[model samples]
Each structure stands twice: as C-alpha cells, then as structure tokens.
Target: MTLLRDLPLSALRALAAAARTGSLTRAADELGVTPGAVGHQLRQLEDRLGVKLVSREGNGIALTRIAEAALPDIDRGFDALASGLRRLRFERRADTFTIAADPSFSSLWLAPRLDRVRAALGRLDVRIVLSIALDSMLEEGIDLAISYRKSSARDLASADLFTERVIPACAPALIGSRSDRDGAGMLDRLPLLHIDQTMGDDVYPTWGNWFTAAGGQRKNIDHGSRFPLTVLAAQAAISGMGALLASELVLREHFRSGQLIEIAREVPALTIRRRLVWPVDGPKARHAAAVAAALAATAIAEADGPWPTKS
Candidate 1:
C-alpha cells in the first residue's frame, strides 16, 4: 500500500486488466491499447513493486498468489473511483436545476402543470423532488424548493406563494339525490376521510375543525381511516369513499374536472403559508426566481384563489 503512493496508476490498471482477462491481448482490447503496450506497463509495475508478480505465457499472463489475492480489492478501488466520478457528474447536472417540494403539492398540484412550467422555462433540465424536510437546502444540493415551510435563514430567500386554503370536496355521486334534489345537507352515515399528518411539519384540520368553522357540532371526529397526504385523501373522496376537507390549491384539477365537488364553499383548516424558497444570491437564484414567477402566474391563470398580489 505504501509503495503504491508515488506509482503511476496506469501500470497497476494494466496489471489488473491483464490478470482479470488472463491475456495481455484481451487486457489491451479492454483498455483500447496494443498487447505490447500492456506487457510494457506490466514490466514497469513489476519493476516498481520489485517483484516478479506476472509470468508471461505467450499471449496469456499469470500472477503470483499474493498479487492474485490483491486483484479483488484493486477492482473494488477502481469501481469506487468510477462511482465517485459519476456522482460528481450527477452533482454538476443536479445543481443546474433541482427543486424540493412538499409531497402533496408536488404530486397533486405541480405534477399536472409541469408541461406549462417546461414551456415557460424553455430549454431546462428540471428535477422536482417530493421528499421529507431537510436540515438545509444545500444538503441535497437543491437549487430551490416549493415548500409549506417558509425560509427565515439569512442565506435563503423566500416568496409567499399561497396560503393553505382547504375546502370540503367529495365525489359528485356522494351528495344528496333521489327525493333530496339538492346536495344541501350531509348524507346519512357519511364516512369522513381523515388526513393523518402525524409525522408532518404542519398539522392540518380535522372534520371536527371544519364542522366547528361552519358553525355546527359533529361527533366522532376520529371516525374514518386516515391518510398521510391530502392527495391520497382526495383520491379516496374521488372514489366515493367519503368527503375530504381538501386544499383548493392542489385539488383545482379535480374540482374543475368535476371529479370532486365542494361540499362547502371554504372552511377554516390548519393554515400554513407555503413559500418558494431558494438560496439568496446563489448560482441558480435567478433561475429559481424566474421559476417562482412563472409558477405563480400559472396558478393565478388557473383560477382566482389564494395567491397574494403586489401592493
């Protein structure tokens, strides 16, 4: 190991390839070099190590027991080096355009409008991540984030995109019918689909909260099955399982497509301000800011809702 510090790696690489393939010709073919060049490198390596580790047998070469034993580790070292280079290359590409986003918003909201975003940004390599909250934006080498958490760090800049505006929406079929022409009141034994954000950074409203907000009283707030994400709950509601107090921000498509109808106009739910966050004066800051503006404009264009306007 100590002798290898100053030695040129090309010779060692030739030895490994020759030993692996059992022939200098095959090694040279793998390395895109002549058999003579491979033999010469092997000679140089043996001279540097001060040992006859390779025995020439025509086009084939045989290694000593110790050198043969070392081949596996040497191969592993080369593999690790190659992996490191690949990681560096990926980091370079990822740093150009990477975005972290809340799972619900990313899956339900932003995913559908990605075409619009791509069209607006134009000539982009975008990566929108739906993952957990990190200790820092730079930890994952993220250029930006569309998150429920606002940035207050000195190194980061954020713009308030929208406030959480949850509303009760359910399948069109679930509402009142038969003799009750209008969907005015709650159905008999209406199954409430609860959102379980127990591990999340923010707490969302329960069925109890919405009922209270609507100036009514309801029991068994914890009756229904709970889902971790609003998008999942919305899907359940869309499937006619029950009503979901969903956010209008992400469920705009469902509401528009008539898969889900508003059981109520709006309800006071667990409110959290979502922000477009990025490193202040970063290499991608300009791009991030441009992305934020494009997204906001897109959201505004979709419908008149909760996006804040310039004063």
Candidate 2:
C-alpha cells in the first residue's frame, strides 16, 4: 500500500513501544529517545494515518481500539525485525567466523577439539552451524565448511582434513581375545552391524567392501542390524549388536573409553577424504584459511597420537 511506504518505521516503533507500556516516558526510555521525541512520532503517525491512535485515560495513556487491535501483530513484527538484525550482525561482523558441518562430525569431532579451534583463532567469535548436506557447505554468509567433496566449484579452495580408513571395531565382550583379530575371523563369529548410509560413498568400508579388500566373507555378515549414522552404529556395536566399520576419528572416544575395541588394525583405510573448504574470493577467505589451517594442524597432531586399545 502507498500508505505503508508513507509511514516511517521509527513512528511505528514508537507507537508499539508506547502502546505496550501505556506510558510514553517508559516507551522513550526503552527506545533510547526523549519522551518528547516519542510524542512527536505518535503525532506524525496519527497525521499520516489520519486516525486517532492514542487517547487520555486518567494519568496513564491508552491506545485507541484500532491501535490496540494491531498491537499484537506489531509486536511480533518488531520481534521479527530484531531477529533479522541479529542474524545480519552475526553474518557480517568482522570478528565473527561461521563454519558449517554435518551433525556426526560436529558432535564427534569438532566439539571435542573446540579448545584448539578457539586457540587458533584468537579474539575471533567462532560459530559452527550444522547441516545434513555433507557435500555442499556454501550457504549464505557461511565462511567455511568441513565437507566431504573437495570443491569442484571454481570459487573455492580446500585443504585436506583427513581421509578416513574404515577400521573394524566391536565391544570387547563380543569377542574373547586379541589373538582372534589376525584376520576377518571375528566377522564370522560376531553379527556385522552394517552402516548402509556410507555404502555408496567412496570411503564406505562395508563388510562387502572389506571382503573385497581383505578377501573374506561371512554367511550373514552382509545383512544384520543396519544403521544410518556412525554414532548409532557405534552404539549398536557397543550393545554387542554387531561388528561396525567406521573411521578412527568418528569412533576415537569409544575406543579410548574401552567401550569399543578395534577388531583389527591391519585393515586398510578408504580414500573418501574430508577437506576444510572455503570461498576463494571474499573478505571471509583469509580468516577461513587461518581457521582451516589451525584445524588441519590440530587434527594431524591428534591423529598421530596412540590408540588406546591394543591392536
């Protein structure tokens, strides 16, 4: 409406503030303006709308029926406006850095290594946004992504974070001794917990894939409890549901806490690597690179450490 454009948001805000508090002085205090300024805005609003928006009810102020009717929506509109402003502030703040990654990676990996991340980017505010899309992280105002594919997009650059090797692991109670881990013999005894989610991925180390690589097969290993996420599969494995094959990074804690033990360390890893990906050209690029470098270096340091359970 032409009338909508003719009215100033400041005047509308003044009305909302005054209407909510029923006191122009309190409204002015909330808005950080003089009470006179607030009164002037109310007059301006009335003149523009050609309606009586306010009236005197004793010593306190009262909004007219029309203004009262619109108060709830007006309050909600102001709330929405404030929320949008906050998002913009987060997106463009010079000292703020935003990164996105998948849920499993965020919880299992980045969360544990947050101290290192904060140390790497001194004085900068760090934000990690999680998304289900593992391959693409180029969302609006997101500076960096811990993503699956190296950017085929020309506008981005990436650094190797880690390529995971699907290590076969299970709860220790599932099998008796370390002596049985020499080959895929455990595959025969324990129920194989299948993570069908990664079966199509380049790094998905399924029993079938492992069989292809390590040369072995079990009758029912191919079809047992199937899970979508590594965490769920890890839990199933801990419950002694079956043998789960996952990357060391994802299951490092389970291994450390002795909840899950590697069935065999001799098993090879897959080539499905993850990278710290970011924009090639933007103000965010340099900071993204610094943070990515720090994360990569810290990852290397951590990955080189000893495995808790025996091989």
Candidate 3:
C-alpha cells in the first residue's frame, strides 16, 4: 500500500471507474485514457492485492465479484464529494443581489418590513442602497428599484404597486389643541416641513400646490423647515416639530396609533402612484415581479380597500 501510495492517484481512479462502469473500455473513454492503460493499472492493482479484480469479456471487460462489492461505497463517496463542492460554490455566491430605492421609502416603508423578507428568503443575502437618483434603473449593478411617480416612462417598465397620498399630518396633541379652530387656516400659523433636496425633474406636491388645487388662497409654501427625507419629515411631524406634508403610505401606522393626525380632509391630498421600475428588456423584470407582488399584497392589506389592478 505504501508502494502504491508512491504511484499517481490516477491509478486508483482507474480502478474506481472500472468498478462502477463494469467495462475497462468504457472507463478509459470516460477518463480520456486508452483501454490498454486502464487494463495495465487494473492488473497492477490486482497483482498488488493478490486478487482477480476484473475479468475479460468478448472484446471488453467486466468487474469481478470483489470489484462489484466495492463499487457502491466508492460511488457514494464520489457523489458526496461533488455535492459538497456544489454547496460551497452556492454559498460563496449567496450575497450577490443588490436593490436600490428612494431614501425615504427605504427608511419608512421597506426598512421596517425587511425582516419578513429576510426570513422568507433566508438563503439569499440582500443589500439595500438608499438612492433618490432616478438613474438607478439605468445603473449597471442594481437588481431591483422602487420609486414614486405619476406615470412610468416608455424607457422603463414600471408596475404601480401603491398610491402615496400627500396629507397634512401632525402630532395628535397639536391637532387637538387646534380642533376648535378652522383647520384650513392652520398651516398659516403652524410651522411646516419640506423634503426637496433630490436633484431631479420630478415635482413633489407642496402645500401651495394642494391649496391651489383646492381653490383656496395660496400661502407661503417655502417658509417651512426643510428636511431631505420623508421619514425624517414624518418624524418631525410626530415629535410636534411642525406639520409635514407626507405620504399616507408611510404614515398609516402613525395615524392608526394616534401618534399623528390627518388634518382637514380638504387638502385635496395629491395621490401619486408608487411604482416598481425596471429596465424593459433586462433580467431584473422577473425579480421586479416578485417585489411587485409583495408590495401589492402589502398595499391591499394596509389600505383595507380593493387594489386597482396594475397594468
């Protein structure tokens, strides 16, 4: 055995192959070696063990009883070895998916629900990048994207997942103190907050826009404290920092908990459809479909209303 150890592993491999295949010629073809070479290794092995491992058959060969008895164990060991290598490769590539979305939605809407996604897809590692840039759909590495817009452009296939309605929300205490007063004029007295730092052509609804849409006198819309993200603006509203024009999609829980109050249903609250956007001809569309379905279920569950079918 020590002398055999001094020889190449290819010799043992030939024996295993011949045992399983039951033919020296077939083993040689599979191993990319000549039949004579395989026969030579078998003869060397049989001589070393003082046993007949294989016998000749009409222009071919067959494994002996000893070879037949050893084959099952040898095949099981090789299968396990192959499976282990495959598992290692799968684990190494596990953390490869990346998704991007609006910063506010990422923080307020998706961040809170990621644990469920993680538990559902335990094997795939995920990375979320907060981006207000509209170019994420064109970015090379992003596998999925979420954004708020009225209509999807022709360049991208956007599925409307939910509608984000802008409403005047403030701390319940703030609303309670002013309950007796005319709620429409409350914005003139209370400080307001804004999130307008994103560099894009997309126009978000503002207080003045809502006022004009309602056929009311336009007030100073730009006189409020500005924040860069919707979640932060909502937090400011929750802490009584000021009344914020924020999305109903992100503030539904706060409204339910009485932490925040929706003031004056007359704001004609702008409803912009939130969408899952992806390249029209890319591989990400299938990935986008899964996200779209999850978001659709979330929307229907949270809204307590029939969701409009997506086009």
Leading candidate by lDDT: 2
Best by TM-score: 2
Tens digits of per-residue lDDT for model 1, 136-235: 6776677778766665788887887767666676787876643331232463257889877632245456667677766776667678878887778888
Candidate 1 vs candidate 2, TM-score winner: 2
Candidate 2 per-residue C-alpha lDDT over 66-108 given as tens digits, one digit per residue, 9 for 90 to 100: 9999889888987998899878876566677777876677888
| Candidate 3 wrong stretches, greater than 4 Å | 1-95, 115-123, 150-155, 175-182, 197-201, 282-284, 305-311
Of 2 and 3, the candidate ahead on TM-score is: 2
**Cα-based TM-score, every candidate:** 0.59, 0.63, 0.58
lDDT of candidate model 1 versus the reference: 0.72
Report the Cα lDDT for residue 240, model 3. Answer: 88
**Model 2 TM-score relative to the real fold:** 0.63
Instruction: Give lDDT per model, in order.
Output: 0.72, 0.77, 0.69
Model with the higher lDDT, candidate 1 or 3: 1
Candidate 1 ranges beyond 4 A from true positions = 1-96, 115-124, 177-189, 198-203, 215-217, 265-272, 304-311
Clashing pairs in 3: none
